[model samples]
Target: QDVFPSKGGSGTGASATRTDPVHELTPELRRARERLLPVIESLPGPIDWAVAYGSGVIHQANAAPSSPLQSPPMTDFLLSTPSPTQFHTSNIRSNPSHYPLYARLLGGSAVAWLQDRWGAGIWYVSMVRVHDLEVKYGVISTERLKRDLEEWETLYVAGRLHKPVLPLLTPPPLLPSLHANLLSALSLSLLLLPPRFTEHTLYITIAGLSYSGDPRMSVPGAENPDKVKNIVAGPGNLRGFRRLYGGLLDRIPGVRWEDGKVAEKGWIGFNGGDGGEGEDGEGWIVQPSSPAYLADLIPSLAPRLREGIAAHYRAAPPNDFGSGRGTEAGAGAGAGAGGTRRPYGSPVYHDIAFWERVVKDPQFRTVVRQELRKIMYRPALTQSVKGLFTAGLTKSVRYSLAKIGKWWKARQARSAV
Candidate 1:
């Protein structure tokens, strides 16, 4: 499949040219990768990519002075493979201990089915001892991962990629999709955010997208309540966010950073929209990056998307949108310039003329939140159910207990404060 599939964009004004991001390992990330070298090497052949992520791996952006001193080493990894069936087949044979007895008996076909078809399209093994370290890892198909990245189909792995990662075995082919994922996160976050906000706020929004409607987050002690803040609060974490998204922010149309308030040492600010220099603003602009972003992101709410597209398309005149239909022909055809007149109910995915107007709907953000909940809620619940089998009841219990304990500690700490 093409790495960065085109979304049928009409490149008009400054075409926010984007490319694959280069991930240079920090000292901590380098150490972490080196630690996981054995596991990386031992994995089955033809693995598309593998990366080490999670709290134990790195400082997680810029850590504020007030933040906790050190995090326990986390050995969380995501492996993207072309053939999950083959990969699982080999893994089950090599490390039968990784899966429960039922999973092994069900065979690779069944396990792969669950991973692809169920809960956010991922299968994870927890509390795994790789060499001297206890590691947890998730497996996903390259296609499924790509879909989540490009289509926001699940926002599972895509949300994880929104933050920086330690690339143990990344290849060039996957870069475009990775960068596009970040851009998508940015586009959605800008839509959800207030007119003006801090860079921390932007990163927070991006980081929280996956968990927004996720039951794992809502249930008491299932997840750390401060998970979002922890991921985004520190200067180290903020710095990571900056490295991943700073250049992309510049590429976004009608966005500019505030005066000197944007600091390289982990501080960033920008005014809302293309507003003038001296107005009450947090710093960055929140416009819909581009027509393509607006066009591409509307699919979650397809009916609304179609309605918006059709309405926007019909409102414009023929010549106005380069529809090629003269005034009279367009009226007769009931199509807008640059838009094909579909029957009463046809999906209009890529009409630039329509996106210009569709994004401006007063209820865009509110409706987006509703649609996103509809898209995310069920998968989040189902994935946790799948975890009982994928990770095994024992491992799931252990992991959940560990998470609950962590949440309790955080709650106590916050309460004491």
Candidate 2:
């Protein structure tokens, strides 16, 4: 959207001749402004016009109360609508092929702009400005806005961006948290596995055989087929392993399985199996470059790692390593015709029950939040976390601005008082 309006429209030509000195914003605000401006400029099509909006503008009325710790707020921009519409229409009409590029450019511009300049705080204001301008200027259709909002909401829920409602809050510590949780779940699952059938050695062996030379499988003795099988085939143990896998899939961005190994490229793979024929077999492999690898690198996994371990347990003979029988019937059945049998006093049953309890338990949610914070805030995880945050933050600016309008106004009121 253009920040400048065209001549001869209702209030479009109105320009404030008055000039105020460009007051220095708090470092945070300054950073936000610096980041957002270029994005605005680079947005697909020229910015017809843009104006300052929200607390960035209102907070200017009086200097914020001096605080030793809190930083001053940043400036907000009110991008005009006609510019966006013209840009979109021109791009689509001129080269429909570029429509996707135009959208991508729009999204990228917003993201890059925010990443470089604004903190999460300014996102809300930006959204409000866009919404207000679109409604008032009739630039973007309501249908389009709704669709955009849906996409934005999906990103927020997936922890892709700082939540629009709480932009000031840091992005969700997904990778670290997932890592911790997966480990915990695994431990719990192992604890629950039936002792008679449970074999840590076997599990380690199987995993090792499967992973072999892959950096992700670098854990000592992880290659032993017996050890890996025990870990995989043992009672509740597999539950924890699956949870670990699933958690990795969720938290690690750009994770993909290639050449039978987990690797991170840019996003995580929700499913196993990279869809390639390997000399070894045809199961999904975890990619090493993925954020999940970080967990593997960590000294310990989270405590909740075991909670869901029971859910993945299989009651079957240990011989079904790659029989492909489980592939069609699912992993729950044991090898042989009688189906998997459970050993007496098997902790597998208990682990399964425990997992059930954990899923329904609210306490697990608290644990998740705690672990997430630990993993996300760690210095080592900063780069990937920042990348994910940047991806989400860009999409958030517009919507956050709309959602936080009232909050900004309230803050302005408090400052005024």
Every candidate's CA RMSD:
8.9, 23.6
Model 2 / residue 39 / CA error / Å: 4.0
Could you give candidate 1's per-residue lDDT for residues 39-130 as a string of tens digits?
Answer: 75675534666777777664542222233774355478887777888888988998888899998999888989988888988998888787
TM per candidate comes to 0.75, 0.19
Give per-residue lDDT, candidate 1, residue 379: 76
**All candidates' lDDT scores?**
0.64, 0.31
Query: What is candidate 2's TM-score against the reference?
Result: 0.19
Cα-based RMSD of candidate 2: 23.6
Tens digits of lDDT, candidate 2, 1-417: 112222221222444221111121234434544444453443344333333332332232233453889533444433333233445544344433322333445653443344223221111222222211321111222222222222221111112111011011111111233234333333323222222222233234323321222221233322222223333443332332332243334454333343423343211233222222112222333334322332232223222222122223242222322434323333343233335533322343333323333333334334433333332233223332342343246544443453355345544565777
Model 1 weakest lDDT span, ten residues long:
4-13
**Cα lDDT for residue 42, candidate 1:** 70
Candidate 1, residue 354: lDDT? 50
